[model samples]
Target: MWPASRIPFQGRGGADFVEFSQVQDPSMSHKVQPLSSLDDLRAVLRALPGPDDTARAAVIAREPTLTKPPRSLGRLEDLALWLAGWQGRHPPTMKTPRAHVFAGNHGVALWGVSAYPPEVTVQMVKNFQNGGAAINQLCIASGVALEVTPIELERPTRPFHQDAAMDEDEVIAAFNAGFTEPLDGVDCLCPGEMGIANTTSAAALSMALYGGPAETWTGPGTGVAGHALDTKIRVVAEGVALHAGAATDSLDLLRRLGGRELAAMAGSVVAARLARVPVVLDGFICCAAAACLKAFAPDALDHCVLGHVSREPGHQALVAKLGFEPLVRMDMALGEASGSTLAVPILRAACQCHAGMATFAEAGVTDRV
Candidate 1:
């Protein structure tokens, strides 16, 4: 179930300057007061088209190039349609695209379910802050705005350690905490994860949702070997059993294994969807959190774009179930959306191709009809 804490409807903290203001009607110069309703004009904008130069160029190329005989551009025509539908028009727009990367560690890592140490999450977070991480560099090159969310979901307080465990309320309390900024006007957002041993948490969560072997989804996380990998699988299996015994709620599941970074990513995705922004997913960690949001609102899946194929065994299973295609195939295990950022330029180039090419008529080519 979702938390009861409300996102205030009227207070536009981050979007203060974005709200519409009243316009003067010079024709009715009698100095009369306006309707004082912003909704009147905003309503019209809601029905208008959504697009940027890339999308509009796609519109000009709406027609397929026919063969001298007949029936050409078969697959290309269909691809155009798919892109159009996403924009709610004939040409899809890729505008103001950006990425949001959330990072955090998991408490379940103490159980030996993963190969990496938790300290690496902190190290990576600092790396991201300094713009040294792969995701940071790729996003810079791709012209994708990046936002790093620092979450503390899986981190332990002095009161609750792994030995004592936690109940539903404790988990829910952690989720009630909010992010510092809003994700509006971000045409496309991508969710990434950071936590050294997070694959253990990911495998456990995948098992809970999909019910498969711990080994089935487990993979070489941060480069662990034979005996260590075996130990990691065993630990994940045990943690799954432990969480099942607790009979935790959805939020509880998020807090217990999803980690704080996962929660932040999940929350940001939800917020962005409500604001009508699209999101691209990095790897297993983002996919795991996407599953959580999928439980709340099935439509949220519409906004996620698949980034890359992960070396982690479970990533393929999760992506398949989510019904998305991974854009890249590198063996990326980094917690950041480095893989997705790498593919952003390709998407941008695709949009550019759609926009910059001349139409059949513009080029003065005769129609075959």
Candidate 2:
């Protein structure tokens, strides 16, 4: 159940808060608070801090003065400008970049949606803690702080191809759990997720959002092959069909198919937006979360950066849906924020270029004639 204070009674800006009475399904042990309705998700959208248009304009204005031909730096120049606009600094600095990995387990894993066992999720959390995971190594090399948070792994979500993955209360709880992080000095937040079969959920959510057949969004997660891959595809197709009616609604799609870590990532994205901190999304899983958030709050895109492009089949489609040009394209599919961490230094360098490069006049260099 949501806290009384968080509950909304009156409509604000044509949005209402859904006040669910109780679980409509007797099989559901937990109370349901439908996040699928716009009424339920409106607060997240409304609560976001508007982008600093002035800072955005300032970056654009400052870019021309840099010691380079106009747009010579190409996307790097644009990225720095985007960061400046959101960071609200004339020359944004990636002084405090943080990476969070949200780990969970999925009941769908039982359907052989992934080649890895469910235990890998727990084992990898330890690997993350011990700085043995790819993400940890990347963060260390990039000098970004890393935190691994395990979410409801012991209690895997219900198999959505059979039933709802989680009840509304569970969804809200996951969101709240992921939403609260210390961001006092953080300039950028990179959110990643780890869960066996999560790609299945990401695919399910993407299909739901994009209105495609499961084959269009489904892919071999964790390198499941042959029979396993075929089973994974079939299971994802079934899940999509099971919740096909909710396809048009974002929150509903999430409630039906999203993993706990996915919901938490979405919540964290919202929290980052509220704090006016920009978010760098990892690969497909994080992008799915961000996509759901964008469906609720379109402005949240202004605060997000696609860290890299994943080889996952649905990733490009999701990126296209959000219209985000990924900062790097390494064909990475490693979860646990590895892709995002790898791009952190590049983003920092972009900020450095914006801040440190001297203008042609300042450098006493002749202009391009």
Candidate 3:
């Protein structure tokens, strides 16, 4: 449970304001167990509960009966079924969707891998708190609650090319910070991040896990290009080469090459899965973090949908690697859950069409002969 009054957030669009105090009972009866070690985390990932087949069957049966022509809605129809299956209930609603943005700094920022300085991460987190960031506005427009968590901003991870980004205990602690976030009444989760030079970390992790040249995974994060882009690519390659042999598995690789924000995003996805909540993965960095889970289990991301295809060069490849067709492609590369928050309304519309549409029989429409 979060400490009393840990964070207070004003509601958007005249909604009642809420505070992070005691943990509210989740809509589902499921409870997340505390993770004490990486071994425990591995076991939990392996034992992830499957979606509710009964609810899925119900969606399939009902979808055909809706007045709309068969498959006219394209991905929207699939979205409804996915929601039903993961929510473990028919007539899934997108009420109370929440977006969590985890922020951390990286020592690699000192190497100029990103155009922005490391201080920008802390500044952006403050912007998020003040409801002044792009994500804050997107969440307001989409009716999703936004929470920003800054994980030890004063202590940036050690440069990965020189040493491990985080020790095992530090990784475990960052992971738990995300794992124990109060899910309570959240119907959907959007996990995103804000970290300087994180794209370098993300690219490093992607290349290490997916096996590609550094150039294949690296991009100009924070608008770096030309010689800076070359620097970013080199950093990714060096970090991956240094840690590749020492990392026993995907999580180990994340610990070696990922920032605290990336680790937290990974943990949040797992927590959402355990609670049977669907997730909307944000841009490149967010996907890179969650992609680590897929190395553990093939269907690890079954409940998640790519919110958008980021303009970042590596994100499209990562999306292909994950086998996800994004809900939208707006050339967006902004982190902080802006893409995923924008996607919430689409899910809401899908659920509304699924649950609110009248059946052909009720509408007195003739069935096709």
Q: Best candidate per lDDT, number?
A: 3
The weakest ten consecutive residues by lDDT in model 3 span 1-10
lDDT of each: 0.57, 0.77, 0.86
Over 1-369, each residue of candidate 3 has an lDDT whose tens digit, in order, gives 211112434544434443322356567445666677789889988889889999999999999999988999998899999999999999898988988888888999999899999999878876666656787678777888877788888889999999999998888878877887777668899988999999999899999998979999999878999999998898899999999988999999989999988988999999998888999999999999999989987788888998998999899889889888888888888998989989999999999999999999999998677
Rank candidates, TM-score, best first.
Answer: 3, 2, 1
Best by TM-score: 3
Candidate 3 vs. true structure, TM-score: 0.94
TM-score of each: 0.72, 0.87, 0.94
Give one digit per residue, the lDDT tens place, for model 2 in 153-270.
7889999899999877788777765565545557788888889999999998888778877777888768987888888878888888898685556776787898888988887777
After superposing candidate 1 on the true structure, give the runs of residues whose Cα lies further than 4 Å from its correct spot: 1-91, 157-181, 245-252
lDDT of 1 by residue, 44-150 (tens): 22333332345435554555542222235343343344444444343444555666666655665655545666677777766765556676667656767666555
Residue pair clashes in candidate 1: 153-260
Question: Each model's RMSD to truth, in Å?
Answer: 10.2, 10.7, 2.6
Clashing pairs in 2: 16-39, 36-251, 36-252
TM-score, prediction 2: 0.87
Misplaced by over 4 Å in model 3 are 1-6, 11-31
